[model samples]
Target: MPYVNIKVTREGVTETQKAALIKGVTDLLVEVLHKSPATTMVVIDEVDLDNWGIGGLPVTDYRRLAATSGQGSGSME
Candidate 1:
């Protein structure tokens, strides 16, 4: 079995999106590695913004700073 773990910040991801992610990951493994989709496993873990960090700062704070500075969109899309 192939195991995949996906971690993202807890924001506004819907159930449909999560299901799509799982299916996409599994399909990719099957196509690239010839893994069996029936046995492939994909796990999604959503962490709070405060618990996730970048540039030594929490994600929430970084996003706010980036937005004010116009340096980043602070969007996953």
Candidate 2:
């Protein structure tokens, strides 16, 4: 059995998007590890934008800046 726990900021993810994320990861695990998708489990823990920081800036605001500038999200600093 494969089990994965993912933590992501809540700003950009929707409920279906979250499911797709889990599906994609689980697919890989099942294919590569020969695990059963039915038995595998995936959990996503959402955090507030204020709780996730990148390059000394909040991920919430960083996403806005990235969209405006057409830039990649800032890296951890």
Candidate 3:
């Protein structure tokens, strides 16, 4: 069996998207590794912004700073 873990910030992911991810991952493993879809496992983990960090700062704070600094879009959307 193949196990895949996917982690993303808990901001705006939907159930439909998560389902798609699981299906896609399983399909990929089946195609590439010849794994059985029935035995492949995919887990999605959503982490809070406060629990995730970037550039030595929390994701929430980093996003705020990035917005104020006129940097990148600073949003997943």
Candidate 4:
């Protein structure tokens, strides 16, 4: 069994988008790892911006800083 956890900021995501995410993740697991769709589980958790942080600052603040710094990708990579 493969369990996948996806976390995103609570930013007005639609049910259709969530369904797409679940399906995409399951498909990726099935293709790459040969996992069974019936045994694969994907969970998505929406977190508040204030609750998700990076570099000791909330995500909102981090994004703001990133925007100002011209690093607007919002990715920690």
Candidate 5:
């Protein structure tokens, strides 16, 4: 069995989007690694913005600083 964990901020994400993510991940594994969809598992976790941080700052603060500094988009890939 293949297990995958995906974490994102606690922003408003629709259920349809979450379903798509799970399906996409499963499909990717099937196509790339010959994994079976029945055995592939994908779990998503939503973390609070305050609980998520970057560069010693919360995501919200990081985005604010990034906006002011014009350094980065503050988007995680």
Candidate 6:
């Protein structure tokens, strides 16, 4: 069995978001890596806002950068 661990911030996480992430990852692993979703374990780890970073900056400043640019456009954000 193969295992995957994915970590993201916890502030805005939802069940649907988690499901999409898991499904997307599982799809890639199964289709590209020839892995079996039944046997593969994919885990998502959530972090506190204080712990994550964006564009060499902390998550605290991510929104400001996003406003300047666009959310999700920043490489590290």
Best by TM-score: 5
All candidates: CA RMSD (Å): 1.3, 4.3, 1.7, 2.4, 1.7, 3.4
Kindly list the per-residue Cα lDDT of model 2 for residues 1-77, writing each as its tens digit.
87899987666678889989899999999789889999899999988889999767887677777778968645531
Q: Rate the local accuracy (lDDT) of all candidates.
A: 0.89, 0.82, 0.88, 0.91, 0.90, 0.82
Model 5 segments more than 4 A misplaced: 74-77
Q: Once all C-alphas are superposed, what RMSD does model 1 give against the true structure?
A: 1.3
Which window of ten consecutive residues has the lowest lDDT sum in model 5? Answer: 68-77
How far out, in Å, is residue 37 in model 3? Answer: 0.8
- TM-score against truth, every candidate: 0.90, 0.67, 0.85, 0.87, 0.92, 0.70
Worst 10 residues of 2 by lDDT: 68-77
Candidate 5 structure quality by residue, lDDT tens digits, 13-36: 899999999999999999999999
Off by over 4 Å in 4: 74-77
lDDT of 1 by residue, 14-72 (tens): 99999999999998998999999999988899998889989788988888888899997
Evaluated at residue 36, the lDDT of candidate 6 is: 84
- Model 4 Cα lDDT, one tens digit per residue, 1-77: 89999999998889999999999999999999999999999999999999998889998888888889997885542
| Runs in model 2 lying further than 4 Å from the true structure | 60-77
Better of 4 and 6 by TM-score: 4
TM-score of 4: 0.87
Give the runs in model 1 whose Cα sits over 4 Å from its true position.
none
Q: Judge candidate 4 against the unseen true structure and give its global Cα lDDT, from 0 to 1.
A: 0.91
Q: How well is each residue in 39-67 modelled by candidate 6, as lDDT tens digits?
A: 98889999987788867877878767776
Q: Give per-residue CA lDDT, model 3, range 17-41, as digits (tens).
A: 9999999999899888899998888
Clashes per candidate (backbone, < 3 Å): 0, 0, 0, 0, 0, 0
